[model samples]
Target: VGSASIRPPATAGRRVPQGNSCNFGQGSRACVRLRGHALFRMAVRNAAPAVLGNALTCHVVAGCDVAAHAASGDTAGGQARGQAWKGLILRGWLRGGLPCGGQRCGSMRAGSCQGSRADVPMHGLLNARGQRRRVLVPPPLLLPLLLLTLLLPTAPPRCAAATSPTTRPEPSPQQAAAARGCSAEALLPLYARIDDDLRHWAAHGISEQLMDKALATQTTASGEKAIGVLFESGVPYVVSPLEEIDRLGHHTGLITAHLRFFEALRETFGPSIPDVEFIVGTADQPAIRLDRLENGALPYPLLRFCKSETHADVLVPDIHFQMRAFNATLLQQLDVINSVAWGEKAEELFGRFSQYKRIIHEHIPTLEVHGAGGENICHHANFELLFCDVREHFMKWAHGVRSSGAPVDVARQPRIKMIDHARYKYLLHLDGQTCSSRLEQLLVMNSVVFKEESGYHAFYHHLLKPGEHYVPVWKEGPEDVLEALKWARAHDDEARAMARRAQRFTQNYLHPDALACYWFTLLGRLAQLQRFEPGRGRRAYPVVLMASEYLGSNAGKAYVQKHGLSRMELPRAKRVEQRRA
Candidate 1:
């Protein structure tokens, strides 16, 4: 059948690889060398000048068309053809004469024949007519030739899938940023916007209009003086970002979030702003003017501080810093609670959710009091009092679930478990009296963060879109939580996108460098606003006094005495005249 029945074409010898495994044939008879495999039944084309002009010049046999493999129900024939094809492709690699479009198939090794095996009708090899003719794909050459056909870059195929006519390629920078999602190209723009906003605020004092958006109406005068003196002083202060929680000696868990931010801030911008100080404002009304304290007293002692978060006069740390949890992927699934538990009830609540499904879990109470409280005064005092406890709501939900035979515990679920569960499940983060700092961290995770609407705003709150960035849940009850979870499961892709968007947003706006730059930029603007007196408040002040108690009475007393412009006095206790309105 080789030469007797079929005439040999000019390119036939060149097309067939130097292998005894394959033979020129049209029947299902096994080629002797390929006794274990079936041969491709190819139809030999007549040796005539190719009719297809300017295409690669080569002879092709039309037997069982390779395309037939796709539609053919003959599994045996398909297997034979595939094995034969692999053998031929291997031969092309052994022999150098095969025109793999002049390109070497380095990736296609004998051990690794796995690649795009789509039978590509490739026109290559230039004949004497200077016209291209179809080259019969050799066994080894089949792989490389197919590869060259793809890699040789040409115009889009006429029969290719249609694309929207409105589509235009993104700019290189944006394309690169989109590819990486959170690279500097994407983040730097957000950082620039942050820097610009802070500069605007620093150039001008906190605006009356901006202050009107306060969640709180009143502020402590002593708190106001402490911040004012710190802001006015041309010195850097090293203050604990946890002073707000430490003052009440409660809400211990809240400190870890802010501490993460301060530590990151020190790591990122510490070198740039060596004199930077961290500060937090009145928990109730950071934006309000603190003219009177609870005791109706104006602030004194003039302890120096630069604002850290909440206040615009001083630099503010964004959510990225606060919510940055430990590397989520490396974290283990087993919840770890190494710290001391407040009490037995707290222990039970804060204990690990051993069999918790990868669903939304929020151990923090919907009411007040974030972490559990201990029976002892020291343990009880460690938790911040927001004056609103959601123990009843949590109990109802927990009891209902447990009664239904599924014991649900949202009370404890440690951070490690939270992050681990987040990878494969939806996470529900309920806000207590104020917003949860863990919200940012949770949102950054791969899981969908179902958030209940609240009055609190992090630095990045303005950037969060309801459906686009997070799944919104009502503060009403567990039903809404269930509904939100249902929606997330139904629209899984959208939920995942929201998670990615949330992550990208945090990486951009809350990046350590971005926050650090915001810090310095705010100071630079504040420096312009300062009323510089000759030899007065213009040395690089880098000392920060951080205390939850009266600054003059605590470690800040010495700092105030040494750095205080006026003889510092322990701020007088608020006159008992008018209070508790």
Candidate 2:
């Protein structure tokens, strides 16, 4: 028998009737709950595994910067596509909940599970029904659709608009010469970070033995274990099915983003695009241990999405694939008021860093904060008081949790556009699952980023200086962030200058055109390092596949179909240009 609370989501036109409403807090709009039915939830998860992974992430399709939430039906299948995505995420939450308060997992009932309210972690809220039946769930985490909302699309840096930060010490002639200039060609913009990743992989060039092992480990799908793709004459022949980001993958797994990156590469290089077979690493965590390459457990190079410099994985343009260029106004009219922050409130990560919220909350009068998602804090340690509710703490999450219902939610902080972030004097950058994917966007904005220490780094992060680009927030504890906040408040000009300097750097180096160019340079460098002939090995297909056939998810299908990318056409060939080694 269905529980009294188990009910359907609100219809488009009707109000959520009475008790069915997900009452978050006073004055807050209710959170939409999933249809409380086990069979239906199971069916939804099975029907679209691809959409399931990204639904909890909202518009975070690698670089998807929603133009006013894409209300128009034109982008990637309109409203229907979005609703399907919502269902997938809601189901995922129901099926994949991790009970953090007590080790006892409880099934969903009355729009909640049998767990302590405080134990809800950061992702969800659980009710304390001590006598309720406890049934174990899988993986144990309700991945609220967002934290670093949409891997932010960064625009081509505008050199004309940049002013050297006034606080920066004068640069010597040598330093000036080394600085990236706007005149730098977009296709071959070189940075030491990109160079470092390539150089590391090139050193371990796929030996004949290594190639054989890599091929053997390959699964049939685009990213089950690994994927195989061959680019020839600027046209790509996907040798395996592609997977969108699912339970296991991050931004790199977005098939649409991957396709866009390849399409851009093809447009730039044409027939000159190198004929290389590669495995794109889609996970936030690097797959191949660079240190353990000798073990041969995993044999080849992985072009990774995350900055894998420390882990020995090859780095590539990550969010750049999904995102367009950042196009917000060059510099904002600064308010220089309270700082804002958004974080991925997963219980394990958030609870570990909950003190950050506690500190920010304690200092609420001076600090106004907002962001999305949360994880329950307690882990069998307490029956209550986990991640029950912290919305009173402003600007705290990355992306808000998505459910099946209308767009409006009064209970939480409203969405803050990346461009609007410039209005504040400061923005806090925190690590979610890895490095914050939106870091590039935050740096491009005029506001100073109080960046916390994180394990992951993007390839471009190497170009940043802690003092020059952003003020550092120590990971030692939450007290450090408090001190950093005080420092920013005390020395305002330096903060502004630091923001200016960081913006200038992006304008010079992170331009969108520079990105397409960077790919060209990166691929050319990889071509130079490739010792073997492309078609000479057993890996070459007798008849290459149309890249569109590789779409393996509903989202991928919608993306390719929405755009006219389903055609089987080769790019016009171009003369191979000589690249600087």
Q: Give per-residue CA lDDT, model 2, range 530-555, as digits (tens).
A: 66756534454433454534453466
Q: Which stretches of model 1 miss by more than 4 angstroms?
A: 1-185, 188-235, 238-279, 282-315, 318-386, 390-395, 401-409, 413-416, 475-478, 528-581
The Cα error of candidate 2 at residue 78, in Å, is 43
**TM values, all candidates:** 0.39, 0.50
Give the whole-model CA lDDT for all candidates, comma-separated. Answer: 0.34, 0.42
Q: Candidate 2: how many backbone clashes?
A: 49
Off by over 4 Å in 2: 1-189, 201-204, 218-226, 241-253, 294-299, 324-412, 536-538, 541-543, 548-557, 561-581
lDDT of 2 at 361: 15
lDDT measured at residue 398 in model 2 versus the true structure, 0 to 100 = 24
Residue 104 miss distance in model 1 (angstroms):
63
